[model samples]
Target: MSLLAQLNAPFMYLLCGGIILFVALVCVFFMIRAYRAGKAMGIDTTKMKRVITASATFTLLPSIGILLGVIALSGSLGTPWPWLRLSVIGALHYETQVAEAAAEAVGLQSLSASLMTPTAFSTICLLMSVCIMWGMVFSVFFNKRYLRRLGAGSKSGKPGGGFGDRAMTAMFIGLICAYMGSYIGGFVSGNGLFRCAGSWIPLGVVAVACLSMAGFMWLYEKKNAVWVESFSIAGSMILAMAAAVGLSALA
Candidate 1:
């Protein structure tokens, strides 16, 4: 059978649908419980409604991005696994990295329908599952202890009271720098997936995104545009994606 046929088989779609339905049910259950708890705690109904509305509004863009990731991975891993994995434990980009690493472990350059076999695909799924499971297990069993060890100030009820927040900020900055460095390296080596007009598309996308974000910030400050404050990141991301496509067309 063709890889596409296999990945998008009827059984796969059914499995994906079932898993998504289960997740939805679980979410609904928790949401109901939380609603009841809020009422029990005498939280104002109007405030709760506003909170929910704002939260959902903020989630719209990120949820769309997650859906895009699912679509992207579905082409390679199929609907069931990507849906299951992303619906559970794993960020969109992290899952893709894990999938690629899993593929590489089995001697594959990249996951393609033509190149993937059942066994290879299973291996990739298993590796990805194990990696996520390990993190989940650690978080479930030892995260609190680890935080305590880091002097997070849990006992004082003022968690991360001192340098912990600063350390975390530093760590996040370092992670961002590492990812940016990799992008730079890819640009320099001409080794990125998308190349446009003799340059990596990612670099151009990043440049466009950074400039867009700066513009948004300027508008938010100088023009005092309140609407742009909440949408700056999503706006920049969308513009970057558009820039990428435009650059690709030029190439």
Candidate 2:
């Protein structure tokens, strides 16, 4: 896990993502085969649609959540206001590690060092516990439904690129976001944006990123297209990272 502590962890994550992507394809191939067998067995297919739709639609919010920063960086990009947004998950990952560092330096039992003070710690802990519980339940629900749809039979034929239609879109968005976040992280880190340590940022940047994403969400509401899914998700990741990193830099 020490390897994970380094900012160089992106390379590791990229490698892991590639391996997982391949594994997902293999699983998907078997799923398709089983799904076809279910049809032969005359099983009802309607139940599967809910899981499929949920898989596609659930990401809609978080995608917008990540793009808040990419939009704010518009002026930095020297582009028009409505240019397509990107993501920065690779960079903002520093926060997770930073928290770990602080916790190690000072015991986790010490306190929450954020703006919340003593009371904020409990609220933050409560919120995180809630999210963890929600994710666990959601995972079980989706996994069981998906497995049921795939049927119990095995022995798959040649696998197609059966990645549920969003693989390419997600990969493209992820690769782009990795680069964008790396650049931003490097710039702020090198330039000393957050005092000597890079832990805070100007609120204006946060506001802009939020507003830009909101504007795009509005545009998205007007135009409903599948291709935009990748853009929206990647965009939100970037926006949120930028907001976070920017805040850190300024602080």
User: Each model's C-alpha lDDT?
Assistant: 0.81, 0.47
Model 1: per-residue Cα lDDT over 1-251, one tens digit each: 78777878889878767877887899899988988889997889777776666566667767888988888888888777887788877788799888988888988889766778889998998898788787878889998989888766366755455777888899999998998877777776655344522367778888999999999999999999967766777788888888989999986
lDDT string for model 2 (1-251, tens) is 43113212455346445655676788789878877877777767764554455455656756564455434432222112112212211222332333334444434543233322333333433332343355557767787776556542224532434663367688998997886665556546746653334322433454556676676676677776534443654465467666777566655
TM-score of each: 0.67, 0.27
Candidate 1 stretches greater than 4 Å from native: 1-14, 22-78, 90-127, 159-161, 191-198
Error of 1 at 146 (Å): 1.7
Residue 23's lDDT in candidate 1: 79
Deviation in Å, model 1, residue 69 alpha carbon: 5.1
Best by TM-score: 1
Clashing pairs in 1: none
